[model samples]
Target: DTAVSQTPKYLVTQMGNDKSIKCEQNLGHDTMYWYKQDSKKFLKIMFSYNNKELIINETVPNRFSPKSPDKAHLNLHINSLELGDSAVYFCASSQLKGTDLYEQYFGPGTRLTVT
Candidate 1:
């Protein structure tokens, strides 16, 4: 079984449109995260939710929002999509082990294209 899954594996939308991507995890992890990988393959964490509480990364714009309905699910909402927003979005979950160590597992990823 897949530990993490994301809906709408591919999203193609026009600039200025709004879209949302849903993610679910069965790993029983306490922390979940949303990451964006640019065309250059540089991955950056957008947001993180620990037990359903939001922790936004400073570099992520306000146009992107992450909502966690529960510990097992985290959704991402993007308002006013732009060409720069085209990237692969990945959903990940992690469990904190002893002494600040963490092991994170990632979903297949959702590819978003903005035209």
Candidate 2:
């Protein structure tokens, strides 16, 4: 079983288009997050959900939204996608409290390209 799965590992689309990226995790963890890694390899946390509740949200554009139907799934939808959004999007998860450690396991990542 996959710990985390994201569809369409690579996506290429024209600017101003709309797209959605699906993600799921089977780790039975309480917290899940979405992070966007820039071309420079800097990872920025975008959204975090705990048991279908939005917890952490960074300063992201309104065009981007995160949906978590259940504890195992978190999806990202983008409107008016821009070239600046062309980066690797990663889905991660971790426990809210455990082992005195805050470790996050990341998915392989979905590479989105806006043309």
Candidate 3:
């Protein structure tokens, strides 16, 4: 079984459109995170949820939101999508210890294109 999976593998939308990406992990992990990888291939953490509680929230724009319905599902909603929001969004889950990570598993990623 896949440890982590994201839906809508590819998304294309015009500027100002709103879209959502869904992620699911079956690794029985308690901590999940969302990361954005830009064209330069730099990864930045956007949000982290531990046991369905908001833990680490980065300085992301208000247009971007992260929601965790349960331990295994995390969803991202983007409003007023801009050209700069065109990047690969990754969903990851790991057994977290304080500020450390263990056995982190990542989804293939959802590539978003804002035209």
Q: Best by lDDT, which number? A: 3
> Model 3: number of clashes?
0
In model 2, which range of ten residues has the least summed lDDT?
97-106
What Cα-based lDDT does every candidate model obtain?
Answer: 0.91, 0.93, 0.93
User: Of 2 and 3, which scores higher on lDDT?
Assistant: 3
Candidate 3 local Cα displacement, residue 37, angstroms = 0.4
Evaluated at residue 106, the lDDT of candidate 3 is 95
For candidate 1, lDDT tens digit of each residue in 18-104? 999999999888789999999999999888898988765658888998899999999999999999999999999887556432578
Q: Report, for all candidates in order, the number of backbone clashes.
A: 0, 0, 0
Predicted structure with the largest TM-score when compared to the true one = 2
For candidate 3, write residues 1-115 as lDDT tens digits.
9899999899999999999999999988889999999999999999999989989899999999899999899999999999999999999998777655756799999999999
> Could you tell me the TM-score of candidate 3?
0.94
Reference-based lDDT, residue 107, model 2: 92
For candidate 3, give the lDDT: 0.93
lDDT of 2: 0.93
lDDT for 84 in candidate 2 is 99
Candidate 1 colliding pairs: none
Q: What RMSD does model 3 have?
A: 1.4
